[model samples]
Every structure is written in structure tokens, then in C-alpha cells.
Target: MIVPNREKQAKLRAFLAKEAHALGFAQLRVCRARDAQDREELLRHFINKGYHASMDWMEETLERRAHPSNLWADVQSIIMLGFNYGPDEDPRQLLARKDKANISVYARHRDYHDLIKGRLKQLSAKLLSRLRETHPEGAIKVFVDTAPVMEKPLAELAGLGWQGKHTNLVSREFGSWLFLGAIFTNLDLLPDEADKDRCGSCVACQEACPTGAFPQPYQIDANRCISYLTIENKGPIPHQLRSAMGNRIYGCDDCLAVCPWNKFAQQASEARLKARDDLKAPALADFLAMDDATFRQHFSGSPIKRIGRNRFLRNVLIAAGNSGLDSLSCDVMPHLDDSDPLVRGAAIWALGQISPDQDFAHLANQKQDQETDPDVKAEWHLALKGKTS
Candidate 1:
């Protein structure tokens, strides 16, 4: 059995810190690959309550996610790394600008999965070389957000940061805007002291949620979350929650933006992860004009491209509906006959919210007979009912 070597481990830890900083990782720490019992129980409870919503993958990977050992049996050490991607401006300010889309700060740039994964691979290769010098058979594996790794809990265990009330890892140095990655290895390494939860009596994050997605301080119900509704849900967004979504066309960042700890956050260091000028606060009208080809070309390397044009347009129409801008009626009315049912449904809602009652009624009458999708037909019926009532 491999035993811990204090002197050798100290050297390895120092080497990792130096290497990680050179690779643009803001923080790095190590922990044992043991079972996280409390986290496992919490995850099981959350899944049992169906808080995961349409994300069935969370329930499916419960065992592998429950403990690092379950994922790779030979794993003895887990290294948690943090990459700060803090925005230069407060995202909450954009909420008041109803004409502009409020995209989450992280999604404003190149996908971190692409940026951080490559960096993780580079760091892993260097670590493997160092390990081979001593333990020639040492094995290593790196993971970004793709794997079923409980990155937050492992991060806290590694002393990288504690999971805040919003359930995202928060660092003293980087605050709420950090991207996490992990590396698991067979070599026995000394674990750092775990970070203690510092949040006390602050309900700012919970209060900032527009849809009240949090059932408690640390738990989130994915069903009502704007991020889940806009980015994850493939079907029409639930009608009841549409108005509360406001102008956020993509993921929402209210909770993250409200954290007082963010006062310490530094702007992102990597140029590739910086926010694009055009994406900062795009006009809702501009997004509604994007066809599939235009959307594919515009969001070519963006994380938003993954949601596809239809889903994206669905979100844009929702924002337009909530904008209360009657002048945008002409722009929205054209989408009433959109090929995609989700876009048509959202267009119906937007037209109802922004168009004159007579105009909406006339269009509804003209299109109602040809609307094939049950959901789109239901949206028209609901809009008409809402108008008359």
C-alpha cells in the first residue's frame, strides 16, 4: 500500500501551485478521494424531491457522483482548480434595461469548457511527468464540467472555496465567478484544510431570485429557475413563470450578482474568456430577427449555440412579451406563423402582451385554424382567454 510522504508531498504541492498559476488557474488545492457522505445524502434528497426537473442525468449518475472513489477506484488524491471569470460590470444593472437581453456573465464569452478543458489537459500532462519520475505507474485523469463529478463539494474539501447559500462555490479571492475543474490521481498526496462556510445571516442571494427558485438557503428547484427554463427545458416554458423571467433571454445571474463577496472579484485574466462587445446587452429585437443560419453564424463558438435557434428564439419572444413595448408588435407578429412550434407559441404570447387586442384577436383568428401543434394551439387559446378576461 502507498503511504503518505510528508516531504515529497510538500514538494509536489508547491510544484502544483506554481504550475497551476502559470496555467492561469486562480487557485488549486488537494483532497483525499474519499466518500462525501453528507453531500451524497443531500444529493439523494434533492433528486428524490424531483428538484432536478428535466435533468435526469443527475439522478442517473448518482453513484458515480456520490464519491470520487466510485468513479475511479485507484484514485487517492483529487485536485480542485478554480478559474476566475468575473465580469467587469454588475450584471443586475442590465435587468432594468428591458429592451436589452440579460445574458448570464459566464456565457457572454467563449465556453469555459473548451478553454478550461485544454488547460486541464496541459496541467495533467505536466503533473503526470512529475509523478512518473517517482511512481512510474502513477495514473491520472482530468475532468471539466462534462463529468458527473461533484465539483463544489470536492472544491470545498480541497480548501479552494466553500459552497455559498446559492450552492455555487465562492472564493474569498474570486467570489462567485469562478469556473471549476478537477484532476484525480493514484498518488497519495496530503490534503489541504477544508474551507469553512462563511455565509451568515445574509439572504441576499435568495432574495435576488426572480422566480423564487430556492426552497431554502442552499437548495434550488430547477423547475422555476430562469437558467433552466431558458437553456435546458426543450419544450415551451411554463406559462405561469414567463412574466417573471423579464428580459433574460439566456441564463440568469441574479443570485451570483447579488453576492457581497463579489466585491473582491478581479476581472477575468484570459482574453478568450472575456465578454464580447456585441453580446454585452443585445437588443431583444435583434435576437428575434436571427434565423437558424444567422444564429449558427453569430453564436458559432458561443455556449449559447448549444441551445439551437428555435429554443433561443423562444426565449427572445418571451423577453419581448415582458418588455411591454407595443411598438415591437410588428416585429413579433411575423413569428406567429414560425415553422417551429415553440417559437410560434412564444410569438403568440409576445403578440398578446404587446399588440392591440383587436390586432391580436385578428391574427389569432387567421392562424388558429392552421396551427397544427397542440401546444401552439393551447398558447393561442390561452392568449385569447387572457385578453377577454
Candidate 2:
């Protein structure tokens, strides 16, 4: 005779490991939520410093974000899983061309959330099917970057990887290229061995940050982060960091792209998330021509659509400013009268860069009558004075 709890745990672990592999997970690990006080303290400190910027959602679900049991109540074991989205091409190559905008590797393909969530849901269904017979009363909930769970720390806890100094979960085998997902379950599965911290004396990610977004190791200032400023932020991008944004029109993966550990990441097994040729390094002139409908059509399944036409154009304007190509002066001119304030402001800033004195003056004169957005007006005033911000 064997202990029932041990047998149950063993059975559940074996079943989960098989199901995860078949469902396309790169790896799966389980752990009890024993300790998270330090992470909780860090979260509070992150809030105190306003490091999250305008992302009030992080503040809104503070309690549930810090604690696992608070989320599902009956979660006895936390299943932290890795979804590998290995880069199909050299990610850093896009940065070489001055006239081409560098879209992040992750956004070069179809959105990972949609693809990974669909797979996670399928895995959940399989788990429930197994539970109906063995652990009929067991409950499970899945989360993928949504919800309040401290996913990076939880992944670290469940032996998926150690949380790198960049605050992203990094595994020795998978590197930093893995997308994390979680399955909160009532079944008490045997916990996996925790991953050890391997980022010793390494500061590659820190030095890679263009805007100095990392104030110290293991922390990121959301306000200066190109990813947060481009994707998450809804208002005007700060003047200082705009120029540092370079040609990265979507998200910045400089820190991740520079990681030495990514050398070991396997190319994505999911073909749908593979990089599209057209998206790799698109011409800025052609990139500027996309209106909302065209933008939606081009980036339908891609993550670039999250920023919409105006914000995307705002990023393009900064890229245009950095381009040093007089040819794009005409391209940036029409945006002086853009419907969105952020776009108009970015246009003003870009025009002051490449525009010959005559064309810029004419643009300022032409848009003077129609412009009412205060921010745009301020930018227009600044541009006429031959100032570039």
C-alpha cells in the first residue's frame, strides 16, 4: 500500500508534464506559493516611485498581484509554464539601417497573447477532462501576462527560470526568449526544483537600455522604457527619450536582444508566430503612408496595431527626425495637421529636423488656422522658431 497523497501528486505531475508537451509548451514546472514577501515589498516600492507610470492597472489589483491564493483562493500548486517564441532571424540587424524602422522581434510576427492563450485554453480543457475522473473537485485557472499574478517571480518560484536583473524570467536552456504562462490549480502536485540565479557579474541588459530606463539591477523605470512609452502609454511621449527611441516603432527589445543567454533559445515551433519578411525592417517612407485602415490591414494580427495610427505615426516622426533624410521631409509635412495631438506634436518636432526653412514655415502657416490642440499649438510655436525637441 502507498500513501494516497503521494500517489495523487505523482499521477497529477505525470499527466501535466505529458499534456504540456503535447500542447506545445517548451517546459512546465510546479511550486507551492510559500514565500513572496520580498516581491510584495518591491511592488509597493515600484508604486511609491511611480515606476509603473500611468499603468494604474498594476496599482488597482495590488493584493491579487502579489499573492497567488488571493487570485483563485483554492490554488494549492502554481504551474508556471514557458512558451518559447525564439527569434527566427537576427533581431539586432534591424538597427543598422537609418531609414528603416526597427520593429521588435516579438511584434514581427502574429501576437503571442492570442496564440499562447488559445493553446493554454486547450491545455486547461485537457486538464479538466483528466480531473473529472481522478480529482473531480479540483479547480484550475490559467493566466498569460494578463491578470494580477507576479508572473516573473512566480516563474522563478516554480523552477522555470531565475528572474534576471532585468526583472524578466530567464532560463539556462531557453534564455530570456520564453513567454511565461501560469495555471493555478487545486491539486497538490509535487513541486519542481527552483532554478538558481545565474546572472553573476553580468550587466549586458543594463548597458543596452538606450534611455537608461534601468536605474539599477532588477528594476525598470516604466516612464523611460521605450516599450512602455510606445505601447502602453496613451499620451505624449516625453521629449528627452523620443530621440533615444531610434527607429524602434513598436517595442524596444534592446535589453532582451542583447542578452547573451538568448543564444540558446530554440526557434519557435509555432509557424503562426514566425517573423514576416515585410515586417522585419520596413522603409520609413512607406511606413509613414499607412492611414488607420491601412495600418489595421498591415498589422491585423501583429502587435503593432495596439499603438494605432496616430501613435505609430508619432514613433515614425521620431524615426524621421533621426533619419537625416531630406527626402522624408515631404512625408512628415502632411502630419502637421494630423487629427491626433500626439501625431501633430511629433510632426512639428520632426519637421524642425529635416525640413528646409521654407517648407517648414509654409507648413506652420498652413496648419495655423485649423489647429486647436494646445499641445500641438505649443509644438508649432516651437518649430517656427527653428527649435528641434
Return the top candidate by TM-score: 1
lDDT of 1 by residue, 194-310 (tens): 999988899999999999999999899999999999999999989899999999989999999889999899999899888999999999889888888999999988999999999
Q: Could you tell me which residue pairs clash in candidate 1?
A: none
C-alpha lDDT of all candidate models, in order:
0.90, 0.83
- Candidate 2 lDDT over 161-254, as tens digits, reads 9988888888888888898888887766678888788999999999989999999999999999998988899887787787788888888888
By lDDT, who's the top model here?
1
lDDT of the structure predicted as candidate 2: 0.83
Give the runs in model 2 whose Cα sits over 4 Å from its true position.
1-8, 35-38, 365-370, 386-389
Note the clash tally of each candidate. 0, 0
